[model samples]
Target: MRRPRPKRGERRIDAATDHLAQYGFAKPQIRNVIHDLLQLYGRDGWVFLEEGSYPMVLNRLLEEQAQQDQDEDGSTITDE
Candidate 1:
């Protein structure tokens, strides 16, 4: 059987949760971060995902995290 669609607000929350999961964020922290991002960025934050910008956000976050890791390691990474 097909699944039912989530209500509007619930859909955003669910998307936030899913986005967090995709980036390896734990549930408890995911809830908080999603809430904060939504609050700070407002509806545009959720809308961006619907418009297919979710992957862009995820990629940016991943790149930032990788840079942080490199900084911590004190070694520079060379791109091929």
Candidate 2:
């Protein structure tokens, strides 16, 4: 069966999926990551119900959360 076309509001998510596919993500992986992102930041008004434009917004939210966590712990996760 063919996949259903994305609705109008899902264009950004669709675009993000296409972008991730170029980087070697399979459909399932993309869907999983997007779901995780949505679960984490879906209620912050970053995601538009009328347009799929949350990837960049979610990235910023993740960065901010990481920084806040580091600040609260008084330490940072250094790459070794």
Candidate 3:
């Protein structure tokens, strides 16, 4: 009887799979969200950034929102 053989250049990533299986949680609903996030990871504006300060990002976003609100409010007053 002939035995099944692995494909060429097919490297085994046992550690990676093990790590994901070990630490990664995938509850019923969580699985879907994880899949969606993975799909968005490589898309435009959804870059895979490993290092960034969450607080800094939050502050920047808040500042941008404040600036946008100010611009809109100021523009309306000048036209009034």
**How well is each residue in 1-80 modelled by candidate 3, as lDDT tens digits?**
99666564341222222323343322332334334544665443223321242232233344555677988888533554
Q: What is the lDDT of residue 20 in candidate 1?
A: 60
Tell me how many clashing residue pairs each candidate has: 0, 0, 0
Among all candidates shown, the one with the greatest TM-score: 1
Q: Show where candidate 2 strays beyond 4 Å.
A: 1-10, 43-80
Identify the leading candidate in terms of lDDT: 1
RMSD of each: 7.5, 8.9, 12.7
Candidate-wise lDDT, in order: 0.65, 0.59, 0.39
What's the TM for model 1?
0.47
**Model 1 misplaced stretches (Cα beyond 4 Å):** 1-11, 27-42, 76-80
Off by over 4 Å in 3: 1-53, 75-80
Error of 1 at 64 (Å): 2.5
TM per prediction: 0.47, 0.42, 0.29
What value of lDDT does candidate 2 attain over all alpha carbons?
0.59
Please report how far candidate 3 places residue 77 from its true position, in Å: 13
By lDDT, the candidates rank as 1, 2, 3
lDDT of 2 by residue, 1-80 (tens): 99998796476667766655664546566656566656876745334522454455345445655787899999967899
